[model samples]
Target: MLFSFIQSHDQNHIALRSNDHEITYGALLRQIDDYCARLTDVDVLGLALDNTIEWLLWDLAALKTETVCVPIPPFFTRQQIDHTIARAGITHMLSPAGLQATGQSASPTIPRGTAKITFTSGTTGTPKGVCLPASAMENVAHSIHTMLGNDFAGTHVCVLPLAILLENVAGVYSGLVAGCTIVLPQLGDFDANYSSLHHHLKQNAATSAIMVPELMRALLLQVIKQGPLPDLKFLAIGGSRVDPHLIKQARNLGLPVYEGYGLSECASVVSMNVPGHDRIGTTGSLLPHVQASITDGEIVIHHPGFLGYLGETAPGHHLTGDLGHMDEDGFVHVTGRCKNVLITSMGRNISPEWPESVLLAQPGIYQTIVYGDGDPHLSALIVPTGPHADVSACIASANETLPDYARIKHFRIVAPFTVENECLTGTGRPRRKNILQQYLSPLAVKETPMNFYDQLVAQTAIARAELYRVPQLVDGLQGRISRPTYIAYLTEAYHHVKHTVPFLMAMGSRLPDEKRWLHKAIIEYLDEEEGHEEWILNDIAAAGGDKDAARKAAPNLETQVMVAYNYDYITRKNPVGFLGMVFMLESTSTQIASMGADAVMNGLDLPKSAFTYLFSHGSLDIEHMKFFEKTVNQITDPADQAAIIEVATNTFRLFANLFGAIPHVSEVRDVA
Candidate 1:
């Protein structure tokens, strides 16, 4: 059916574009025929390539031959890749390098009529294969093309990975069905560099593109920075719930933006918003190919074009697991996931996405996940826009729009969830289980019961390992040293230490009213840190290095960035976060400062005066850590704890860079 649409189009019309290469319908069809001929003996084909002309050709060829095509997402971990190969019983694999045999020829028992298997990396580490039929996929594509009409039948740029079902069926297949030229840019070329991506789109005169909310946000920002793409007629945003305000913002700026909803089980798109029949808050009207109704507050799709899982029997109907409803105008309004709905202790059920979307609409709040399944009130883990974000005010403003029970009572400022951390799905949805395991306790009802100090210690263990792994720190611990390298370390240390008192003073002055108790500790820190830079200069002088030169030397780029980060972190972010730097410095001093001093001194035969700063800090920080731990234990606010943890994590990373930038013993020897 898809091939017929392609074949019926003008044979000379450009069908695919990647970089500078273009393939007309005639050439595309010929290439697909050649690919189909080669796949005659193959039972299952694993397609693993970036967005390119060849990827589309191979995909269409697989569809033509009725081969069980498995599109492997590049972002899948090695374990996931291996699992997919074995689970799909893949016989041949096609990657950027070339097609190769996987050595496995066993035919897996998938659902009958399955033409393609797309893996969805859900809330877990492992990805599950969703078996789809060619007819079902074609139906969805045809419906999308029909709904979008001829206005969208122009250049359609592929903004997302072709491996994703949403981009595959709704974007590429639908564009082909509409006889639109498909532009296949390398996913990485524009994934992070939105400016280049928008430029590519403008250069191609792209009229339509499919994007997730995250990508849409980036592109919108880019458009604001540069200017709107004049040729763009349709931009469909999906993969996760989008803030309606974002859609409104895009339209107000004259960028055509629409929100849609779909899942892997439905062959990608079940409903969408188009140009004339547009609605802001809803997921838009249902597509012509699928029928949806609310059953038991869960969206149920009848004959949803789904075949079944790889090994499971096909169900009569698909229970979408998404809770939503169709309004009088036939638009679908998705509330949230049925399983993700939180039942408070008072028995009031609330969807976390409700307050979460509201929170996200605020200026400073970037990403948030709300939780309080069996607790009295809701809490959230929020990733602020930047260090200067006033998250308190943002949360307060978001609360004004939500019911009291669903209002966020407590929130922790944390790092952004990423696919690398396995805390977020590839589609930008938070893996609630993984996030809760990493941030909250196992039960997911409340914050971890551990004290703030203990939690900090537990959370930063991996970062500490990374810090310890720096070559300089490792070699220094093992007694590998040079006199010049030691002096270089002292030079950088002097530069950063000079700012210690100022950082403390700034932190003390910026403490919020509720954290007034921390002011005394900050004052004590200021007094202890006042002359620490002079000690490093004295150590430099005793070590036979020019103390005056060391005192006036500029800090290395890494050291300068670290100092700037701390200052910015103290002034812009939560002042309490500065304790993270103290925790890192003092705790590290107590652990390794004395031992490293002894190793360097004995190895280089330096005088005891040369070790004054290290020796004093080694012993002095022990009592300081005791005081620090006691003070941090008194902090019960979730936001404060989150700030400290985030800063400590960043401090460990930046400090590692600082140590890494120091002149290594081997480098100095080579230089000499």
Candidate 2:
């Protein structure tokens, strides 16, 4: 599709616009042709430009010449840019010039420049350049045309800075492939919220525009304000992480929304949700001819034709840092990220994000992060609900009934979470290590045992033990608190939960009889989580609220390790992979709702509203679960049904202990 656009339009229609000036495809082609004629050796040069026509010209030229191009955001400072460029061994630099880095300096040395470097956003430190080949840029253009086909032809506008790979590939290069009129709005001028973006979209009869999560959010906000754009054909939202609620809300608002997966390494697209065949959770099925899979729960792309690295001649397949599953239907659904996986010391593979969502759902916790992979226990960072609210107390309360491992062991109270000013990524995912560096340092610097919260509970348990032991029995409770008792308490709690299981499955949810067996199994194993307070409080109170007695409870994370290579296999990933995940999560939602309700009603005393009070799965994840279903319903891929079953089974195992197992505490402990 894109090839046809390029081949036919040495002249014909408009190709790009920046602010006021409009350039024809013929003219645009001529500029690229000229650049190509000028610098043939500048195969893999760097592309760093704001959302501008010049950037488009260079990008198209690079693609046309088959140069492996490295496109970086204009916002990256000199240090970042230089690090990438030097690593990639790029020979050229292209922009209108004056690209600012924090340290004001420029390498004004080469005409055969445009030094391209595919920098790893860096899992550890010192971001390394993946170093794409100069001529590989065109492969992405080829990939897009092969998948979406050449039918797309209309006005496509720029809503993002041109440097982003998604915006560059789909927004600009794709448009050029279709020979569409490119509309460039004024810099920094967006629709009042998203309404204005929609207005401009309608005004120009925009068929497509590239988007990031933030842009999609702004567009949704605009849709709410100004209503939906009627003519939008494809609104590709990618880059960074995207939430399904946001997608569904946009769909409800009447946007022709579809999502896909791609990486800077893969020329911006690995899979996408087409208009009719869209799936919510899985990135749309692999684009025509692209191959994707989940190998041991990690995403691997096999594009027989992949881009080469910065100036390097070596070639290989692209393996991603993302962890995902391929359903029976073949669509790919990303789960937790492999790079960011938070494995507890107990070997329980927990997606901290899974719990983080629950915490964030609470209005009280503006920002909450759970971290303790490989540590003895889980801990968290919470932005306070309010000035006066005690964060430690909140943490304690939240974890009161939680099993030992998943419970937060320590925490920091950082209020008013701010991503800007370099605390977070442009995409808002925590710079986890950075977060550790900032908050964790305070404890050591103060020269206090970072055991402040730990001691608080310890002291409370001691006091409680004393109270329980009062000889006069002044409303006193008596018992010796010990770790085994807390464990026993957890055990008893689980036992009391027997009837809760069957009742919830029967009373709640919309599952069929055959699938109801899952509910039955869930119910049977649910005793472990019952009467958690008794387990925690019993140990503390037995010691007369003695902190020392409370401290006797040995802490350990849930250590259940099971490698799911069967479903998590990297080779079988297809659209089915996506559908499989969708179905799996839905099944779990049904089970969780049933078990959660039982836990609450049987004896937990939790509020009915707490289930969906925007603080837990009842609140945010319910939407996530739903979107997976909806995405599946939209899919035409035959692999979907099978994918559903595969993902569901995997989901079951991943959460088996957390959901199905019961709690057991051997002793009563003080209120820490």
Candidate 3:
């Protein structure tokens, strides 16, 4: 039934494409038959194969053998893989290496018609297997075929992993049934890197594709920068709530993105918005085969759906655990997950998704998660549209539309969440528990202690204060500094500041488990230090120097050695010692650099823009020194303390040497 096109039309018609190879309908069916003969004894199989013709062949072979197949997501952790293997009672697994018998047949007991076992995202805990009949998944495909009408027959690119249920059912099965060629590229080719993905889509002349909201945002940015992807006619997006404003933006850019909603238990898609029957924001009306209703704000699906969770009894009805409603025209509008609802300390109930949608719709917001379960007011963790985006203004715009209780009272900008970091689910849902535990406490409180540790750190800083007064540095600064001397100073600063974030990242990564308390501080430091090197380049341009030449310039010997030595110290020796570099730099800035900015500015008669780096560091280091003191004070071990002091003294000596190396430019030479 799946390959009916082989009988009705040309058997040599291409069905699947990967790299430069194409599999025709005749070849695909023959491969499936060959695989079924080899795996006749296997009742249950697991697929850990990448996106390729082999993955599809194995899946079709399992269907022909009436065997239950489990498609394992490549992104799953080892622990999760083990859980799925044991729970699904997988007898064999097909991977890139080849098919191997798992020797794990604990329990094969499932509903009589079980064809595939799909797993949930497992954000909160262990993922539960949803056993679906072959017919149920096929039903979704048929409904999507009918929904799309004549527009269904075209090249469909599988942007999401095949293991994702949305792709498995709506993308693959639907495309196959409609007799459309499906392109399954390696997952890495299309993920995160938007420019490459857009290029691939254009090169392949992709007519339709499936994308998550995050990828859509990236593509939106790409389209805005580049031109439209005219060949890409249909884009089905789901897996998380989509921002309507993002949808609006995409439409304006000529991108054909349609929002839909589904879950594993529903056999992938329950509703979709097609060409004629479209709703801009809401997920379109439920497909013909399924029925849905809002029972006390919870989306309840009435259908003979999944058989049961693995090793568990089946429930009568599937409560999606999602709070949503049906609109006047039968479209399903989802707010957020029921479990994610927050009740304020004053007994004010709020759905974070409602306010979050408003926030994300604002121009600067790229990502946000709202929180206020027992707090006085709502707050959020935000990632802005770009490094220099005005998130505060976005928050202000979002607040104007929200009620007092639901509005964000405060928020902090954080690094973007991604699958590689385990902060986002495979399908782009935030792991709320992980995010809140890692960030909420640190962002909510000022964690610096004020005890003996603080006093000891203060004493250490005081002892190193004289490092700012090296004779060559003091004499050069005390006199009127010339243009060339100032330019040399900036060039060296660029060489070192360019490594600041990378070095901090290395230090943070290498820090021991006992140093867990310092992780938040390190991330905070990363946020501040990420692009300071660019400021130096801007200053060079403002000073009428060749910014391009300065960017390509090599670091002076002293500066290179200082950076190289500290990198070695962090990696080979104690990581805590690297903080000594911070102490040397910030202490010098706080003591002399702040005043030095004005002195050099007046002496050189350069614009204020020329001193962006110096002036920023001057004021910025005052607060940074305070944070550094608190962070260093928390180094309780005597061994750690000694390392910090030794490194600090050595770093000071290096700084003094770097200053001495810069050629003094007298005023007559500078003017000439």
Instruction: Report, for all candidates in order, the number of backbone clashes.
Output: 0, 119, 0
Model 1, global lDDT: 0.83
Off by over 4 Å in 3: 191-195, 442-672
Task: Indicate which candidate wins on lDDT.
Answer: 1
Clashing pairs in 1: none
Evaluated against the true structure, the overall lDDT of model 2 is 0.52
**Pick by lDDT: 1 or 3, better one:** 1
Whole-model Cα lDDT per candidate? 0.83, 0.52, 0.78
Report the C-alpha lDDT of model 1 over 574-630, residue by residue, as the tens digit. 989999999999877765674577766766778999988888988699889889989
Higher-lDDT candidate of 2 and 3: 3
| Model 1 ranges off by over 4 Å | 191-196, 441-672
Query: Where does the lowest 10-residue lDDT sum fall in candidate 2?
Result: 472-481
Q: Tell me the lDDT of model 1 at 657.
A: 97
Per-residue alpha-carbon lDDT of model 3 for 1-672, expressed as tens digits?
665633454577788999878988777788888988988778788999889888988898887788899999987878788988888888998888898999988365667789999877668547778899988888888888888974657889888889988998899988888877889888867645555777777778888999887778777765544445778789998987876766876775568989998878888999888888899879888998988888999999887477888778778788989999989998889888988999999898787888887777664678888987999899898988875354655666567667888888777777787767777886678898887876776446532233533333343432243343444454334334577777887888899889889888888899899887888988998998888899999998888787788889987899898899899999999888888888777767654554466656666678999988878887788789778867877778888887777777788778877876777744432311
Between candidates 1 and 2, name the one with more favorable TM-score: 1
